[model samples]
Target: MMVAVDSTEKSCLSADGEDFFYFGYGSNLLRERLQIMNPSAVLVSVGCLKGYKLAFGLFKGQENHWGGGVATIFPSPEDDVWGIIWHLKAADRQSLDEQESVKHGIYSPIEVKVEQEDAGEVMCLTYQMNCFNYSLTSPLYKEVMCTGAKQNGLPAEYIKKLNAIRTNNYNEITPFTMQVRDILQHLQINTSE
Candidate 1:
């Protein structure tokens, strides 16, 4: 789907480009993966979205599969989630949609209110987890929450809450799981234990 860019951000671009704002929370939060996924994407800023928590959804099975947590859209009066925003050209969004599995309904876009670093506010299209395929069995789930905790300055209580999540005892490596492992290595956390 095409997202219309606000008139305010248009001047920042070089031409009459159809820009699409995407809010990324999971592995997409890691710049390396984003670079691999969309090399042309411009980093707009770091931002936050209220009323969601990251969790693994859109599952294929317990093994030889993976999924990532996305902001689950819901009504909340006092919750906010942090993430990165990217301004992508509409032409490149088709590949992103495919990478994100949009048509299969594994992901659906939503217009979210986001706080920009310098621009203040922007309406962006972001994806939410399918929820139908969520399971928290892997230790990587905790690793991801810990990564978010370290990167986003999330509260320790939040990390504790994340650690408390119930999963189905899964033992397969998803890309998301690999990401957490990478994050640990990046942080110089020993995995030898």
Candidate 2:
């Protein structure tokens, strides 16, 4: 079931004027990917959103910039989605929304309660696809998610689940795919140093 965010929850999410918490389960799970646009984001903790399952889909019959499906969450009583909690400056909110294509109506911002190991339950801002039309993600896109999952130390079982997701296996070179590859390469190099 979808939990509504009450006024109290909203206050708690942004108690301070400067920052707020964001739950990232998709490509945004990667620090480098997020920082490309929202540089002020900082890793706060890892958390799990119960009663939801990870899904990949095309938004309104349109493929994502990566030329494949993108990640979103759906309510599922028996499932849980693990992801990173990022604390970001309030000023970065617009950039984050733009990154998620909020203005385009591809994703809608929602509030979710995430269970954190040390902090307990906290309300955070997350996005869900407006329309869920199942589609396979590209191999490179899935690889980025898997790499982020491992980087954040998510459970082995969850990582395995992420890896098991079938890909479109798109190998044809395109500008969008090339851009993603370049970003991944640059981020990997920076992390190593």
Candidate 3:
């Protein structure tokens, strides 16, 4: 899906014009998770999307690879969702879209205005779920988001809210979760350096 850009929104393209900004509110907020498929992704800034709230739901009532619901954003008049702004090569767009399951009709790309402290309002590409049947996310999935939020220095109140989210209590270690765990471990180690 093509997102229309408004003239007033700040451009966030890289110098070569071969990169674009993406606002990641869900699993993509985790650097390791995003880097797995889109290696060109680089942290740009932390921002908040006003007038939207974070949500989790099953896609077509089916659990995702994470073994439970996945994260998405929905319109909320008084809320704001805090997340990371990533600068990525234009070549990674297809892989990023696939990671969000856009081709499966699970998500649809949308253009949003993110309020950044340093950059002001910038137009970015983000995704929202097509289905909103509320569901619980897996414990590991929630952990990934919380870790990313903390690691990236999102607001304390927002991190507290993320920590308060209830999980599906999926304790069994799936192969995917195991890989994610390893990535998180490595990320933790690297961040400490």
Candidate 4:
């Protein structure tokens, strides 16, 4: 799952030669979620992605999970998507890409400008769904988004929008999905979300 990076961004690597910035507009907005796979992930800032809107239309191909869509960004001149900026070791980039399903061609990384307080703007890699067919969202997935949004302290209005989103009550048929539900329950999560 090699991602062909243009020579331009290759110049932005950190001095240690293993750090890169990422703009998280989706579930990865949750530092904890990203940390699950990449422990070195650090939240550098929070900001809005201008000229883009959050969309839950990217279908997940993973089996025995939510039969709904995940988050991605779409062009919208009138909107801004609130998200977090993360810095991780460059060594974990491929693992992060795999987590986002880059090998399956589900998402592709691209450089985008994010506006953060004090920092003004920073160029970082973000994932965008290449799938065109829009779909519904799963309730559990929505819970993750809402929890993540609140954890990052996004705008009140944006958080409300995320909470208000409708989701499909995707039944747990696969053992993995069921176990996920069990874990959420054990943790006293808001499954109704």
CA lDDT of every candidate: 0.58, 0.82, 0.84, 0.73
* Model 1 RMSD vs true structure: 6.3
lDDT preference between candidates 1 and 2, better one? 2
lDDT of 1 by residue, 1-193 (tens): 2233362532322223566777776556554455566766666776677776555544343232343333344446677666777778766676677666777766666677787655577766677645445544355544554565455444556556655766555556667667656766775554344
Candidate 2 residues 17-52, lDDT tens each? 556788999898787788889999888777899999
Ranking by TM-score: 3, 2, 4, 1
lDDT of 4 by residue, 7-98 (tens): 23253333345677788877686666677677787787777889998877754444325668888898899999988888778778878888
lDDT of 3 at 96: 81
**TM-score of every model?**
0.63, 0.87, 0.89, 0.80
Q: Model 2, which residues run further than 4 Å from truth? A: 1-8, 12-17, 187-193
Model 2 lDDT, residue 154, Cα: 84
Model 2 RMSD, rounded to 1 decimal:
5.1
- Per-residue CA lDDT of model 3 for 61-154, tens digit only, reads 9866798888999999999999998878888888888898888999988888898756577788899999668899998889999988887789
